[model samples]
Target: MKRKWKFFIGGLVVVAALGYLGYQGFIASAAYQYELGEYLAQPGIDASQNVQVAGQVATGSIEQKSFDLKFTMTDGVNNMVVVYQGTVPDSFRAGGEVVVAGRRDPASGVFEATQVMPKCASKYVAE
Candidate 1:
């Protein structure tokens, strides 16, 4: 009886330890959300921070070279160039609201986007 209790308690401890580690990992890896203006205004952001910057894609700022996508995101006041290395979504276009997720390139002063999520403005049409 005592041996069975010992085994059960050990299993619970292992499970709890795994759960704690998983939670910590998730928190560390989660993307920090910021507006384009706020992100650029920061004196210096943590280089290791995984960030999601939300803004409107500036007009006439998109340039496509093969699968590479480069565009400027603006908060109607401040702007920053975002360089993404993948095909953008079908909803992606100039003047569209988008959230780019990635870390800033300390060398080039550009946000290196890993993902571009376009928030379509006209998806809902009231019938």
Candidate 2:
């Protein structure tokens, strides 16, 4: 009877630990997606809030610095400089589609990226 009780308690603890870890991970990785046009049009977006915005990198806008990277992302009509402090993706370059996840500073008007996800076309066009 004592052995059964100990096993039951241990199993319950392991399940609870797993559940808590999953919940924390979900919270930390939550992001909202917005197209470049839609995000630029919204004037009411709060700078303090985290968001994920997708756009193509503007030509001749990439500049690498010692500690950070800077570039302009545009939807053709409007563009904003993004400051990223993470390793850039190999597929990321000028004219490539990318999704940046982070918060924007109201004062600087620069998007501070936590993660930069580069997108590529799955299928190539036939010549």
Candidate 3:
């Protein structure tokens, strides 16, 4: 009976540890999506937390230096500069819509993008 009780307690401890890890993972991976205007309206956005912002690429704002890219995204009312170091998507271009995931710098206000997802123009058009 003592051996059974020890085994049960060990199993419970393992389950509790797994649950705690899962919760932490979920919290770390979860990111909130925002439009450009909505993101700009937030006065106290946490710079350490990852966030996603969607907007149209500003015309004449794309500049690339090898794998590094710099561009401006706008929501007609506000604009934000985005800097990313990665392969540019084939569909990305000026005037196209994009969603960028990363943290915004508190000092410079530039968005340091970890990922860029270009929205296909054709797929979003009304038939």
Candidate 4:
């Protein structure tokens, strides 16, 4: 009886280990990070799929409205237009570094940003 119990416990451990490995593999295949240039270069990236794009806001390209905003993002060469319909981040500004999370609109050639994060300015640090 003791031997049977030990074998059962070992089997349970092995099953748990396999389950963990499968979970890790699934997560590894799900998401990834890429800069704006690399993301654009990838062929057949589904425009409807959510993604994060990092780049600097183009200088003199930010247009603000009462409840909407339009801006251009650039990784020095490639540029992507971003449209956001929500409140802008505190660090948002022209020529500032930012990461926009959203899906691309293939027809309009714009990224509809659902979330935006701005890189803090180096020159202005809190004391």
Candidate 5:
């Protein structure tokens, strides 16, 4: 009876530890999504926190050099410069909608993007 109780207690401890680790991992991996204006309006935003900002690509703002890309994203009222080093998506273009994920540089106020996802237009047509 004592042995069984000890084993059960050990199992419970293991389960509790696993649950705690899982929760921490989820919190660390989660990125907050924000609109361009909303994000820019926040006071003292944490530069180290990973975030996703959605905005429209500003016309005549895109500058590409091989794999490096730089552009300005706008929410009509606010604008932010985003620098990304990766393959540009085919759907990405001036005036197109895009979601950029990464951390913001505190010194230069530029968003250093790890991923750039362009919003694709709907292919379906209604009669």
Candidate 6:
């Protein structure tokens, strides 16, 4: 009787601990996806939250202001301006597909990108 009670309590504690760890893992890693239109519509997005926005850079819209790079990204009708301070990838050219991860300053309406990755097309090769 006593042994059974002890085992049941121990199992319950282990399950609770595992559940807490899983919740912690989810909270520690925060990621959000935004389409260009949805992102533009939300003009008040918190700048401190890490986010990923998918879009294409508008052609002839890239401008560099000192260390900060600015450009207009578009998804058909909607357009949003983005800014980043770091070095850009060699393949990051105008009208190219890219996934940008960073924070958006609501005050300035500029996206400060911490990381930018280009999406390249996969070519098939005959073996």
Best prediction by lDDT? 3
Q: Candidate 4: worst 10 consecutive residues by lDDT?
A: 25-34
Error of 4 at 92 (Å): 0.5
Per-residue error (Å), model 2, residue 19: 8.6
How displaced is residue 118 in candidate 4, in Å? 0.4
The lDDT for every candidate, in the order shown, is 0.92, 0.89, 0.95, 0.86, 0.94, 0.83
Question: What are the per-residue Cα lDDT tens digits for candidate 1 across 1-127?
Answer: 9999999999999999999999999987899899988998885888788899999999999999999999999999998999999877899999999999999988888999999999868667889
- Deviating ranges (above 4 Å) for candidate 1: 122-127
TM-score, one value per model: 0.82, 0.73, 0.92, 0.70, 0.85, 0.68
Q: Superposing every Cα of model 3 onto the true structure, what RMSD results?
A: 2.1
Give candidate 5's TM-score: 0.85
Higher-lDDT candidate of 1 and 4:
1
Query: Candidate 5, residues 30-99: lDDT per residue as tens digits?
Result: 8999999999999577887889999999999999999999999998989999999999989899999999
lDDT string for model 6 (1-127, tens) is 9999999999999999999999988865686988878877886776777889999989999998666788888887987788788788788889988788888877777787888787785675789
Give the per-residue lDDT digits (tens) of candidate 4, residues 30-82.
Answer: 53556989988985888766788899999999999986999999999999999
Candidate 4 lands at a TM-score of: 0.70
Q: Give the per-residue lDDT of model 2 (tens digit) for 1-127.
A: 9999999999999999999999988876677799988987887987766789999999999998765899999999989899998678789899999999998888888899998999987789999
Error of 4 at 61 (Å): 0.4
Better of 2 and 6 by lDDT: 2
TM-score of 6: 0.68
3 versus 4: better TM-score goes to = 3
lDDT of candidate 2? 0.89
The residue ranges of model 6 lying beyond 4 angstroms of the native Cα positions read 1-29, 65-67, 122-127
Instruction: List pairs with backbone clashes in candidate 3.
Output: none
